[model samples]
Target: MPDIIQLLPEYLANQIAAGEVVQRPASVVKELLENAVDAGATSVQLIVKEAGKQLVQVVDNGSGMSATDARMSLERHATSKIRSTEDLFRIRTLGFRGEALASIAAVAQVEIRTKQPGQDTGTLLLVEGSQVTSQTPTACPDGTSIAVKNLFFNVPARRNFLKSNAVEMRHILDEFQHLALANPHIAFSLYQNDLEVFNLPAAKLSQRIVALLGNTYKEQLAGCEEVTPFITVKGYIGKPESSKKSRGDQFFFVNNRFIRSAYLNHAVLSAYEGLLARDTHPFYVLFLELDPKAIDINVHPTKTEIKFEDEKTVYAVVRAAVRQALGLHSLTPSLDFEGDVNFAPIRPLRTSTGGNSFGSGGAALPAPARAVEFNPDALAASVAAAARGLSAAPKSARCPRGPPSRPAASWRPFIASWASPCARPKPKCRPSRQLPRCLSCLLHTRSRPKTRARSRWPPRPWQRPQPARHAGAGPLRAAGREVGPDAHRPGGRP
Candidate 1:
C-alpha cells in the first residue's frame, strides 16, 4: 500500500496558509496598505472595486522593488525586515511575517510594478495561484504599485463565505482608517468603485482624525500626554460629553500599529467613571510608545492583538493620562464658592428702636439680630415667678378606668360589687299614656315611639340619621344617649 502521509503540493500548502492570513477582502487591503507604508511612501492611494471582491490595488510614491526582489517576494517566508530570530523581539514595523504577499498571491491574481530610484526601467511581474505567468521590464513611475484581482478565485469555498458588498466595504473602510491614522504625516486617499471616499492630506494627528471620522470631532478632542520610564502615552481623548453609545471610535495603537486590548480599554473607561453614562464609550486615539522587547505583537495571526510584559503598569498609566485630559479640559464638578442660603444673615421682626414693629406709618425696618447674654440668676428668678403666677386647670369629665373588654383580674371582685348612683336601674316599664313613654330607649326625649329598639351606643359621627319608620320619630332624641364630644381623632396630623 502507498504511504498515507505525504507532503502536499506547493500550491496546496500556500492555499492553506492563505486561509489564515487572507480572511476576507479587508485582510488583503490591510496587507497591501501596510506594505505601502513600510516602503516609506509619503503619498499612497487605494482603489477597490466591488468591495475588493473583484480588485484591490495600492499605489505609493516611495522606494520600490527591483525585478529580482519582486519575484522572490512572492515566495513564502521571504522578508528583508528581519535577519535573525532575535529580531522578532524588537519588531517595530508592521507586516513582518512575510506571509501576506505570498498568501495573497496564492488565492488571487497579483500584479506588481515597481522600480528603484536609479533604475532606468521598472519591473512588472504577474502571478496567478502561486504560479508566475509573466515577468518583464516595463516603463513606470518610481515606487511600488500592487494590484490584487479576482480574490479567492481558485478557492470557491472561501469566496462563497464573503459578506454583502456594503458589509465588506465597511470592513475595508475600517482597515483604511487604521492605517491612515497610524501614519498621520503620510498622505492617503481611498477610492471605492472609482468614487472617492476619503482624501486625507498630510496633517497632524488631530486634523487627520477630524477628516477621517467626521467634522463633529473637531471641537470634542482633548490632548492627553503622559511620559513614564516604562511607557509613554500620548494622544487625543474625546470630552466626556462627546461620548457615544457604540465603541467604534475608540482606538489603541502600539508603536503606530493599531491593536485591540480590552484590558487597556477598561482602564480608559474607569477613568471616566461618573462622567460617561452606562453602556456609553468615549472616543480616544491613544498611542503607546515603549521598548519593542517589552511587548509581543506576534501573539496573534493578524498582529492586531499584543501582549504586554507588565500589563498592570500600562493600565495605570493609560488611565492616569485619560483622567488628566478629561479634568483639565472640562473643569467640571467645581467647588461652589457661593455660601449656602440656609446660613444667611437673619433680621429681627421687631426693632429695638422704640420696640416698633412693621405697622401703619411707623413701619420700622427689621434690625440685625444680636447675640443674647446668658444670665443664670435672671433665668431662675423668671422661672420662680411664672410658677407662682400659674393658674389651675378646670375640672372636666373623669374617664372610667377599666378596659372596655373587661375589668382587670386584680379589680374584678371590687368592680363586681361597686355601684354608682348614676348607673342605678330604672323601674320596669309600665304602659303609661303620658310623657310618650320615657325613652330609656331615647335617654332624654319628650316624644318617641311607643316601643323603640335599642340603637348602638356612642354613635359614629360619620353615619347618617335613619328616617322615621313610624309617625313620631325625630332627631338624635330618637336614638340612644348622645355621644358627647370625643376629641381623640383630630386631623391625624403628627
Candidate 2:
C-alpha cells in the first residue's frame, strides 16, 4: 500500500493531457494555427494530407524561437505568453496554456525547424511520443515550420475514432476559417492534398470575408458598429434575404478569439426576430471588445466559452447595436403611403448589328411599339357594352340542338349516354334534298324540352346487380354454386 501512489511518468501525463487538447486532427490544426498567430506571423501557410491523418504542417514567417526556447517549449507548464497568476486574468494573446505543444508531441511525431532573423543557422528538432530523438543545426529560412505527422500514432484507439476523410477535412476547414476570419490583416493560405483551397491576402474584414466565402457576399453584407464605455461591438451582418437554412455562417469573436455563447447568440437572433424565417439563421461575424479582466477565458480547455462579469449588459448592448445597424441601413421593412406606385420602366439598351446605317453610327433605335395611355372610363364603358349584348341574347340561341334542356348542367349526362352505342337514341332519317336545310337549322337554333322537371340527368348503367342479404348470414352472397371449405380436400366432392 505504501508504493501504490507513485508519480505518473511525464510522457504518460502529457499523453493524458493530449486527450483534452488533441481530440482530433482539427483540434491539432486549431492549436497550431493559434500558436502561429501568437508568434506575430503575418503570413502563414497550412498544408494537410489525407485529411491530417498523414500530415499537418504549419509554416509561419513569425518571430522564431531560440534553440533553448524551442527545446523547452515542448515541456509541460512552460510558456512565453504568461508569467504569473495575475497575468492569466489579464491575458491578451492566444495559446497561453503552454500545454498545446507538450500534449501534441505526446500523441504524434513532432518536428520543428526554426531560426531567428539574425541567426545564420537554424535548429531542427524531432520528437516521437514526447521523446526527443534528435536536435541538430541546419540551414533554413528565418521563420518556423512545425509539422505534426502520424497523429495518434501510438494510440490506436484514438486513431480509430477519427471520422472519414471528407468529415475530418470539413472540421479542418472550419478551424482554418475561424483563424482566417479573426485576423484579416494576416495573409493565410491553405493547401490540401497538393490542391490549393484558399489563398487569402491581407485586407479589410469585408474584403477578407468576400475572399474566404465568395464574391457573392459583397452585396449581402451590412456593416455594424457600436461604441460605448463598457464594450464595443463591430462587424458585419448579412441582409435578411441572405439568411441561410444552415448555421455555418454565424460567428462570434470575443477579444479577437472565436467563442460560442448561446446567450449572446440569442441576443443577436432576437435582433432579427421577424426579419428571418423560423428555420433560417442570419449570417453574422461580430466581435466584442472589452476589458480582459471583466471576462474569464480559462473556464474551458478549448477556451471557446467564456464568462463575462456583466452578461446582461453585454447582451443588451449587442442586441441594440444589431438592431440599430439593421435600421440605419434600411434593411428593415418600412411603409411609405406617399411613395410613387408607378415607376418608369427601363428600356433595354440596343446593341449595334453593324448592317443598318443608324446602328453603325450608334444612333438611337426607333421604338418597337407605341406607348398606350390607360383610360379607366373608356375601359369600363366597353366592358358594360359587352355584358349587355350577352344578357340580351335568347337562351335557346346560345346552344346547339340534340342536347338536353340545360346545356351547362346536362352536358356530362348526355355525353355519357352518347358514348354507349346500345343506350344512345338513333337520329331520324330524311330525304337527301332536305338534309342541308335540317343541318342548317340544327346548327343555328338551340333545342330545349318543354318539360320543366327531370327525374335524373342521366340513368345509371345496367349490370348484374348485387344479391339480397340473408337474415342470419353476413352480407349478400354471389350468384354461384355454393362450395364448402373442405371441397378441395382429397376425398371431398365438388
Candidate 3:
C-alpha cells in the first residue's frame, strides 16, 4: 500500500474558500464596498458593466498600500487585520477576516493601482488565478483603484450558476444601498453600463435616506433612540402607514456592519403588534453600537450572523426605542400649520383678463363662499318626525301577503303541539334485558359485577339500557315467557 495524503495547492485552497465568500456578483460587491469603508475612504466610486460579469471597478480615495503590500494581498490568509486569536473577539472593521481579497483574486482577473501620500510613484499589479502576471510602477492618483474583470473565468461552473442580469443587478443594488445607508458621512456613487444609477454626497442620515429611497420617505420617518450602559440603539423607523408587505425596506446594522437577525426583527415587530397589517413589515434602518467584546462575528464565513453576550438586553432596547418613536408620531399632528389655508394671508384681487379664464370679463372672481352655522336641533326634529310617520303606517300596507290556506285557529293548536318537546309520545313500558332477582338466584348464585367499561358494557342514556331494536332478541324469549311491554323507568321508578 502507498501513502495517498497530499496537500491542496495554495491556488486550489483559495478557490475552494472563495465559494463561501463569493457566491455571486453581489457577494463581490459586498466584499469590495466593505473593504472601501474599512480603508477609511471618504469618497468611493463603483462602476459595473454587464451587471458585474465583465467588469466591476471600485475607486476610493483612502490610505493605499505599498508595492510589497499590494503583492502580498493576493496570497492566502495574508492580512494586516488580526495578529492572534484574541483579535477575533474584538473585531470592529468590516473586512477583517483577510479572505476577501485573496479569495476574490483566486477566481478572477484583478488589477490593482495604488499610491500612498508619501510615495512619489504608484504601483500597478495584475493577477490571474492567484498568479501575479506583472508588477510595475505606474502614474496613478494618490489612492487605490481596483478593477475586477471576467469573474469566475477559470471556474466555468461557478459562472454558469449565476442568475440573470436583472436579478444580479438588483442584488448589487441592495448591497450598495446597505453600504451607503450605513455610512452617510461617506460619499458614494454607482454607474452601471455607462448610466448613472446613484451619486450620493456626504450628508446626514435623513438626507441620505431621501436620496436613496425617494421623497415619500421625507414624511414617513420617525426617530428612534435609546442609550444604556450596555448598548445604544438609534435609527429611523417608517411610520405605520408607510409599512408594506414587502421586506426589502428593512435593515439592521451592528457596529456599522449590515446583519440579518430574525430575533431582533421580532422585537421591533412586537412593538408594532397592532399597528401593522397582517404580513406587512415596517421599514427601518436601525444601527446598534456596543463594545466589540460583547459580540462574536466570526461564527459564519460571511460574518453576517453573530452571537451576542446578552441578546435579551438588545431586544429590550430595540423594542423600547421603536415603541417610543411610534408614540411620538402619534402625538405629532398630521396637519402642517404653515400650509393651512385658514391661516393664509389674504391677497388683493387682481381684476385683469390676460390669460386667466376666471377674469375673462376684467371682473374679479366672486368673493369666496361665506361660512354658515348649522342647527342641530332642527335636524333632530325632522328626523324624529320622519320616524313617527313611518311608524304610523298600517302593517298590511307595509308588507303584501296572500290569503291564508287554513284558519289561524286550526294551525295555532297544531303548531303548539308539534313544536312541544314532549310531542313524541313515549311507550307505556317494555321489559329490559335484565332478569328479576328470583330468576337470577335460581339460575346462578354467582353475581355478575356491574361494569360500565366500553369493552364490557357501554353506558346507557336516560332510558337506553336496552334499545328498542333489541326487543325481539331479549332473554325473555329464551326463557319461554312473554314479557309485557313495561320498561324500566329512567330513575328506577315504578
Candidate 4:
C-alpha cells in the first residue's frame, strides 16, 4: 500500500488558485487595474495585443516599490493591504487577498519594472510558472509597469478554452469601463494593437459618462441622490425613452466596487414599472455607500457579490431615490387635481375689425347671435315657392302663341287625371282651347322625349283635339262616375 494523500506542491497550488482568479483575459485586466488603483495611481494606461492572449500591459504612475519589496511581491499571500484579521472587516482597497499577482504569475509569464521616486536605480523582475527567472537593476521611471505575456501558456487546456479575440476584447473593455466609471478623477487610456480605443481625461462623473458613452447620453441622463444613516445612494439613471432592449448598460456599485444583485435591480425596475416597456431595461450607474461592517465583500473570490445587513431598507431607499429623480426631471407623468373644473384652453379670437388676438390680451368678442326659432307656416310657404319655380318654363322654350288661359276650375280635371291609375288620353292644345294657368305651366315645363325635340314647340297630343275613345272622356268627370273619352268636353255628360 502507498500513501497517496500528500500535500500538493506550491507551484501546483498556485496554478489551481489561478483557475479561480484568472478565468480569462478580462480577469487578468481587472486584477492589474485594481492593483494600480490600490497603489494610489492617478493615471493608468492599458495596452493589449491579440486580445490579451499574447500580451497585456498596465502602466501606472503610482508609488513604486523598493527592490526588496518588488522581489517579495511575487510570493504567495504577500500583501500590504491589511495587517490583522480585524483589518479585513474594514477593507477599502480593491485587491486585499494578495493572491492575484501570485496566481497570475503561475499561469503566465510576468515582467515587472518599478523604481522609487528618489532612487538612483530600479528593479526589473521576470517570472514564469511561479518561478523567478531574473531580478536585476535597471533604469526606469518612478512608477510601475507590469506586462503579462503568453497567459495560460503552461496550461494548454485553459488556453484552448478561451473565446475568440473579439469576444475576449469585449470582456476586457467591460472591465476597463467599470474601473473608469468608478474613478472619474483618474485618467485612463486603452490601446489595442496600436489603435486607441479610449483616452479619457480626468473629469467629473457626468463628463466622464458623456465621454465614455457618447454625446447622445447628455440629454438622457437624470441625476439621483439620497442620503441616510444606514446608506447613501447616488448616481444617474437614463430616461424611460432611453431604455434598451438588452441588459448590458445597468450597473450597481457598492463602495465604488461593481456588484451584481437581482434584488436591488428589481427595486429599480419596480420604480420604472409603468415608464418602461416589458422587454426594455433602463440604463443606470448607481453607487451605494455604507459602512463596510454592514456588508461582506469577501464572500466570493471575485468580490462582486455582497450580503447587506438590511437589504429591504436599501431597496426601498434606492427605489424612492430613482423615482424622485425621474419626477424632478419631468420624466414621469403627473396630474393636477386641484385645478379649476371650468378651466378652458385659451384660444385665438378673430375680431370684427379683422385682427387676430389671444383671448386674454384683447377685448372680449361679442357673443354669437342666437338662432331664430322655427315657424311651420313660413317653412311650408318656402317649399311651395320652390315647387312653383320647378314648374315654370323658360322663355326660350315657350310656345309661339302662348298657351291659352282658362279659369282656375280647369285644374280639377287635370288633378283627377293625374290621380287615376290609367293614363287619360291627352287633350288637344289650341289657342282657342283654354287651360288653367297652373296646368299650362306644368305642361310646358314637362320634359319631352328626345325624338320629339325638333318635331314642334308643343306636342301634338296636347295641342290638336284628341278623338274620344269613349263617352265622357274629356277633361272632367263627376264623382263616382267612370271617366270617358268625352268627360273633358265642354258639354260632356257628368
Give the whole-model CA lDDT for all candidates, comma-separated: 0.81, 0.83, 0.79, 0.83
TM-scores for all predictions: 0.70, 0.70, 0.68, 0.70
Once fitted onto the true fold, the runs of candidate 2 whose alpha carbons sit more than 4 angstroms away are 337-459, 462-494
| lDDT per residue (tens digit) for residues 285-314 in model 3 | 999999999998888887789989999999
Stretches of model 3 off by over 4 angstroms after superposition: 331-494
| Model 4 per-residue lDDT at 278 | 74
lDDT of 2 at 375: 96
Q: Which candidate order results from sorting by TM-score in descending order?
A: 1, 2, 4, 3
Clash count of each predicted structure:
1, 0, 5, 14
Question: Which of candidates 1 and 4 is the stronger one according to lDDT?
Answer: 4
- Provide the clash count, candidate 2: 0
Positional deviation of residue 325's Cα in model 2 after best superposition, in angstroms: 0.9
Looking at candidate 1, what is the lDDT of residue 302? 94
